[model samples]
Target: MNRKPSTIPVPVLMMIGIVAISFSSIFIKWSAAPASIQGMYRLLFTSLLMLPFARPYSGALFALRKKDWIMLIASGIMLALHFLLWMGSLKFTSVASSTMIMALEPVFIMLGAYFLFKEKTAVSALLGMGIAIAGVIFIGWGDIGISANNLKGDILSIGGTAAVAVHMLIGQKVVVRMPSYLYSLIVFISASFVFAIYNLLMGIPFFDYPPREWGIFMLLAVVPTVFGHILFNWLLQFVSATTVSMNILGEPVGASILAYLLLGEQLTGLQWTGSLLVMCGLAAYLYAGRKKGKDIAPVLDNAS
Candidate 1:
């Protein structure tokens, strides 16, 4: 008889990865670079950092099929767009507004799966999504009614959320057929090309970024983008999108705490309460779904 390998629980891995990714906002804020410049460096540096590990010329990256290449490039461009929009949001609106709105990416994913892909959703997951959305609503309310001056930031954040949703859906389809590291390599390489072209067209100075800025950018590429995403992509091998979405409840909480500690950003009591509600609902959803054993949703196999 063949033996199956025992694996670490997927939820634990997802939690850790999501927590690591949450630190990204803190690093970006600390860097204090322009959003476009930050977006450019993020892809460029992450590509360089990951290339050594992925060994793209070892026939790994090129081994992908034509269709896979298409999806990989699309996902990469969408990721670049997400980074650009969300980072720009920082300049226009409060962090609370941006994080809260971007948190709705999962909701968009759920909607897309239902309408676009015809994937079935569990009642528990739906309920959890609803409760989590309420928490988001409260957080958004807290951040809203600021000056109309911040409207551009709010719009950018929403656009970022849409980009994120598209990226996740496309990735779910692409990742199963290839190793996550290779998939990430293709995506990052494509995104770097897009950023390079955009920087050239905009006449933005892409080089000679200060050393301190370069150091921060390097940390950003290594820590959140490389480590966090690698782990998250690995978790997808064992987990469902709903499971991943549930884990996202931690991002805002982790971000809020880090912001307070590192950036002197304070959270109001209401925001804390809202954050807690998000966690509770996500916990309930995951628990209920996993108990049924049919928790993992069906991903579209055709993309691979």
Candidate 2:
């Protein structure tokens, strides 16, 4: 008889992951380097730091099939593009506007999974997506008023969201077939390579950045890339994909709160309302998924 697969508990780990990843924007803002240069620095430092844990030079990476290699490269390239668009969006938009627009990631993830991977979406997922969209629309209406600059930033943010979704969707497939650590090492390495090339191509002045900017870049690598991605990969082992998707809704809220605390950026009433609705929708979806997991555990155990 086959045994049921073990999974990590989702709630606390997922929350931590989102909050850690949400710190990227603030860190980027704190760094004085040019956006693309900052991204390049962050990716390089993050890949080097993750080396101890990921150990990509090991035989395990060499043993991976050609398909896994492709996934890793694709994930890396997509993530690099995601960061490029996201960091660029911040230049022309408020943190609030950029974050709110970037929150559309989960929506694309859900839709992409349904279409690309043929993952069945629960009615609850559809409903949660609707709620999240409404919340984004509400926030957008309030703080993202139309201007040429705002429109440009909004477009870039949306492109970032799409890029990340493609990255995650490809990553999910690769992780199921190989060790997550090995797969992630490839992703980090590829991202670092892509960013380095981008910096070279753009001719961004990287040599003049001060030690303060380097310090911020180091912090960003440790927090969001290593800590956040590790936690997110770990949480996936214990939770349903839908549960993980719901938890990502916390990113924008956590980011907004952090910005308010650190930068004195204020959150409007509409933003607060949207955040609450997002939380509510996520809560509703996760509650149902957890109950379903609990319900299925015993029957599968008995079969084993």
Candidate 3:
């Protein structure tokens, strides 16, 4: 007998995902490893952790259509690029600048949706997005500089933003048909393989790191990779890609707070105001989404 799959509330999952991912920047900052090496370990560890749950759905994996595999592969590669470029940017720029630039991903996602899906965005949603972006800019006001290195970092962060936007756009289309666990496992494995190859080609060692670095790698996998990204992937089955991307705007607020508390990075008065603006923008965005009849309740109820 066929049975419907049980589901969690999408909003709850999104909140958890946001909180989990907010820790990602902090984790990256704490690690002493190369960006590629850290990325490889993060994805590799996540793939291993997901293997057990994913094994139960092995039959479904073989049953995926060719087009699905293509999308998954592309999404996985893009995901790898997003991490590599964004992490690399962190090496050259302030976390505030890097994260604020990366926050522009929703703009790319919205553009892709309009061109590919013929999706029309609401005015209120657009306003909310603008406000959120403005808030991030304000938060990063003093941090962003025009030096050559900062320019390079900004470009890399923008590249990462584009990569993730494409990944999420593909995910929205594919996750509707693929089981979340199976989808996550395949994508994680694909990214891990790509990063592993990149690390090897760049002469980045896969091992011999200190125990603290290993622990940081493991935390990266468990917190940001597993709970953060995997949860977002699951939510893609319910929410629009733009919505998912917009939710990520919350990351800057959380990341800023975490940086201040843990890393002793002080926040300025302008940054505090910007943080409030970000929260307001997010609330308006979600409220506007609901007003436009884009609630996830029906989607959750219909999931099988």
Candidate 4:
């Protein structure tokens, strides 16, 4: 698959994608609804917006090989769980802690590769993972650190991060076979159904959300889904995957800033230190990719 440079300036695309993805945590916080509901409407609206473009690739969706179907379904499930778990964490934890926990993602990806794909990490990367985890412990353990609720949020955030990493892994397996938009469309719609089923089983009301809630839902769809993950995925052909992956490190910083300005949230000293440590460790882990000649593949946006 021969790929050309993006017609748009790559830095401009990077800024747009980073700023867009960063708002995902803020959007989730803006909503008063369940995470499943927010994810449902976000992905559903995303699917609708893609319908115009999807017509061309709709056939490929059906023509997927059996392995592709399995991969797509598993990818969809992981994506759904990622949102459901991660967004829920925001209710109980500070945006700083939650996003800092997401910084553990590269660690999860490395571990996943070791177990699932038999990939090995160098000692340097392993030490980096340890530093990052210790940082997250500080983040999650701020003043009143032993609060069970905060711990629950931290756990949920970790689960969410791991889920999305698996989503990316499964996506790595099948994405090359078809167009990205088509694969995304199939996965998003599948995730929508997962939320739908969950809502039904949990007896959560649907379609009764107020107008502002509806607006937030659409914002989640457009801001993060379209402008964030979709744009980041598209940018892969034009830039190094490491370039794109590194921009994701901005989420903890960006989201924390947004949280302070919009949500009146302030990070404790420990949280600030943890946030810095997380970035340093994850940055080190990602650069190790250079030595191995393998960057993390394009990832699904978890903050989204």
The most accurate candidate by TM-score is 4
Model 2 scores a C-alpha lDDT of 0.68
Question: What TM-score would each prediction reach against the true structure?
Answer: 0.79, 0.80, 0.79, 0.92
- Per-residue CA lDDT of model 3 for 1-304, tens digit only, reads 2433428777788888778878888888888899888887887887788777776787888889999988988988988898889988877665666676666565567778899899988899788777877776665554443356765776787788888778878888888887766776788778888898888888888887999999999998888756776666566656665566555567876777777788877645765666666567666766676678764221110000
Stronger candidate by TM-score (1 vs 2): 2
- Which regions of candidate 1 deviate over 4 angstroms? 1-19, 56-60, 149-154, 231-247, 288-304
Ranking by lDDT: 4, 3, 1, 2
Q: Of models 2 and 4, which has the larger lDDT?
A: 4
**All candidates' lDDT scores?**
0.68, 0.68, 0.72, 0.83
- Candidate 4, which segments miss by more than 4 Å at Cα? 1-9, 143-146, 300-303
lDDT string for model 4 (191-252, tens) is: 89999999999999998889999999999889876788778878888877778888768778
Error of 2 at 101 (Å): 3.8
Name the best candidate (by lDDT).
4
Question: Candidate 4, after superposition: displacement of residue 238 in Å?
Answer: 3.1
Please report how far candidate 2 places residue 167 from its true position, in Å: 0.3
Model 4, TM vs. native: 0.92
Minimal lDDT window, size 10, model 3: 295-304
